[model samples]
Target: MSDNLLSRFLRYVRIDTQSDETSKTFPSTPGQLVLLEMLKQELTELGAADVQMTRPGYVMASISANTRKARVPTVAFLAHVDTAPDCSGKNVKPIVHRKYDGRVVKFPDKPGLTLDPATSPELRTAIGKDIVTASGTTLLGSDDKSGVAVIMTLVERLLRETKRKHGLIRVCFTPDEEIGRGVDKLDLRMLGADVAYTLDGGPPGEICWETFSGDAAEVIVDGITTHTMEAKAKGMVNAAYLAGKLLAALPRERCAPETTDGRDGFIHPIHVEGRTERSVVKFLLRDFELNGLADKGKILRGLCRGLQASEPRARVRCKLRKQYRNMAYWLRKDMRPVELAREAFVAAGLKPYDHVIRGGTDGSRLTELGLPTPNLFCGEHNAHGPLEWVAVQDMESAVSACAQLAELWERKS
Candidate 1:
């Protein structure tokens, strides 16, 4: 299928692949497997060898080495198939804007919501490019779907042009990345790749190798309940009030998402559920360094202890669990991967910007598993929200970069 990135991306996003965090299943959602199965069948039709899909919604396919060189290293390209659980991925309606002029863009479905260049500065970067977005009611799923199109397009080009020499290329599409369980059950050793790059970043010409070290914390508060007739006379504690008190007592100066940016970490309360007798507040803690994350965890624990001291009759517990670590700092033993990606971007006729991402990707977990996978740009902007968009030109540039990366490695010998 020689479909354009726009067509391919639209086709992929038409399906609802939102992952579930509460599900105990490996993939967390059956919809993810539908997309993964589609990719598996399409890869097989594309003549990719050793195509296989795992029960957890990981699809792996390989393109054999075309070069005669025996020393070529196996490289992989990856993206996720699932969309974020934060937004509705059901019945997404993507709108295309051709030859964008610098103006205030409005979503057709929403009369009041506007995407201004001043508020979303990233829109400024796509002034002259063809942009794609969803209606105001839903996210476009371009976060990684555009990434899927980029890799798929590159595969078609490499297969058609027999003269293009390259080493073995492995393509992987994972699920539940938005929920942070994309690679939880991945079989890295079986997949067999020396190095990899995830097409899962924002803007064009970006090479991200560093990501935040992350942990999820849950605060469980238990309270006493009394009859309404004797509420004041009998001992009664409101757990929801206790949870809110602890949330308000959290350090907002240096530990809040709004107060931090560009490598500084934050403790963000993403979800809260409570009753009069019980309440649970979930937080995501992030830091570039492990010690910083540990400090945040300590602060949370200290808050719980203080709450206990103030309310001896109530039971409050704070538990911080590891999600993923900073991949670049923990596993990258060489600079060649970073340099090669830069070279790839330059070959695609664009300057590359390498930065420490404020968030995590599937590459973060894969790198932690010893593959040293870095992230490549796919033009995703304002991801996981109704304001998400992707530039067509930027996606084409990413596809060119992927192809150039293969050619560069072949020429490296």
Candidate 2:
């Protein structure tokens, strides 16, 4: 059977596997287990060894070494099964643009939403190529689904094609990556890979190892509320007003998601819940520098302190938590894994380049768990939103890269 990359990607995204951030469960969503189960079954049908879906809804499989090398390192590839909750993943309608003509494409479902070439110059690369996107009502889910399809397609080819020589290859699909809980319950000891690569990056040539040091904070305000018509300032502290004051105290022009770009960190309020009696504001802080992340947290604490001081009657408290760190701190030690990826790109007749993930990946947490995992490009563009798209050719390139990557490792050993 010919590899239908787009068909696989579109099929997976249709399942509405959006993860929940507020859930206390390990995977945080039952829908993700359905996708994970499907992957596990498919891997078994593909004759992959040790295919199993663990309790936490993780699907792991292995392809035995076909090469004669005695010391080939075990290389694994990973992708997340869950989609981001920032947009609606339910009832997603995907649109496929055949032979893109280097122009902006408008969506029929959404009146004003269009894939503009100016804002996303990456679309220019898809000129004269096939592109897959969503219909502006929902996200395309290419951020990691494209990665899932690329790895699954590659695994099928490797297991079927007898002449393809490679080392022991492992693959895993994780859950809740968007909520920063992807690897929290992942059993790295069971994965048992010397080094790994996450097929979860945008563009074809990008090889990401450096990601932002991340942390999160939540501020809660408690107010003494009474009837608004009967109260002047008598023991009535509005939580909504205090929440607004805390948000307003932050410097938006200096360190906000909208105002910052490459190498500059930003602090953004991701979600907020408000009422007259209580309010909650959650923020995500990111920076390439450790000191910068710490400073953002410090500034947030100071703002909360001032807000509390000003609104003496209201109770305000801020709790900060650590998320993930830059993977470069671990990858730079040996650098061989990155070197092997570059060699694979060269072998696959493509140019390899370095990239930085402004956000974290399963790789970030996996690397922190003592496995050197770097991110590989899998054709995701305009991720986590309505304008998301993927070039079919970039996915083909990723498949070629994955196949040749294992071969490169076997040759070196």
Candidate 3:
């Protein structure tokens, strides 16, 4: 089982399915469809029925139980196939280190790069385990590939082992999840699961029930451009200066990523482009609470109004668009699946730790679509970076957890 996990994870990561945020297409990149087709073939070979790859790279499969149980709830397991756009996922070389020595391990390709224990405090807990890492020149793409391996291995194990009594299990592998457009083209009716769990969180034994309510703000500043040789301040309004001033007016302590954690809201300036004629500033606003998020938006708009007042000749326009909402809102009454997940973890001999995801997941949007989905871990850490790594043991445990979830759903029926 462990060998299967490692081999499948390495195989998936080598496919280079990086999502394109700038693409107007549904799946974002054609490479994602390549992996989706491969998964469809693998699922069919594993005896899964109704295996299909949709137009936008959504792969769906179902495994029917041999037992003659009545009214068993159909539980689904989901994971993303595309890697993040933050780093390169091409030509990935997975380096497996057996029996880690708890020291600073260096990559062969990049001698200067090493996994330092002092910096990554999480390594102290992973000592004496077999881990898979990258070659330090590109990301390992372990974020959701680890999840993919867990689901694939669990399905194979259930198909081979005749004694495990489980109900119908649906599996899905989505594309473009890293770019916030993963669920945009998802067909929930085709999936047909009463409840689902996304095996796409970081680290083992971690469950995320909450995610941020997010929005994107685009501020465009229009200014009159005058020739450099033209007389002093007569007809010149520097748009770049206006952009800088608007950014500077924002609260310094509340704008940085490093200073925020655990339900703390922030305004992150992601893109800044300027010329004399016009300038554009892009920011992402995130908050866990709805009322607080509304307040934050008000503050941002107030800042823009101030900028407009300060620059009479310059025109400033701000557009704020809501992206996704907090999943916590629906987790109270619509969270039986989360409770089942906790019991499943305990049955698998693991303690479940629930945490708020600092970012959004496809599960967040799925919950709004009436699936009532939550996120589970697959043991990958430092995702979207060259230093990303996943523990083989944790991956195996995740597979067990998934199998346990299917059994629990059957028992509930």
Residue-wise lDDT of candidate 2 within 1-413, one digit each (tens)? 22477778878988888889999997898889888989998899889999998887789999999988788889999999888999988888888889999988898889998888999888998999989888889998997899999999999888888688888999999999999998888888789898999999988878999999899999999998898886685667889889998888889999998998999998899998999899999999999889999999999999988998998888999999999999988888879989989999998988999998888888887787789999999999988899889988999899999899988888888
Candidate 2 matches the true fold with a TM-score of 0.97
Put down candidate 1 lDDT per residue, 269-373, tens digits, no spaces. Answer: 988999879999999999999999999999898999999888998999998888988987855678687888899899889899987799899888888878889
- Provide the global lDDT of candidate 2 against the true structure: 0.90
Kindly report which residue stretches of model 2 are placed more than 4 angstroms away from their true locations once superposed: 1-3
C-alpha TM-scores of all predictions: 0.97, 0.97, 0.95
- Candidate 1's C-alpha runs over 4 A off are 1-3
Q: Each candidate's lDDT (Cα)?
A: 0.88, 0.90, 0.87
lDDT of 3 by residue, 1-413 (tens): 88888999989999999999779997888889888989999999988889998876799998887567988888899999999988899889999999888999799888899898898878777888899899988899888999999999988988887677788889999999897888888899899998889999877778898999888889999998888888266689988889999889888686556678877988888789999889999888888888877877887899999999998889999999978888778887767888888999999999998978988899889987788889999998889999999888999989998888888888877
The per-prediction tally of clashing pairs is: 0, 0, 0
TM-score of 3: 0.95
> Order of all candidates by lDDT, from best down to worst?
2, 1, 3
Q: Which is the better candidate, 1 or 2, if ranked by lDDT? A: 2
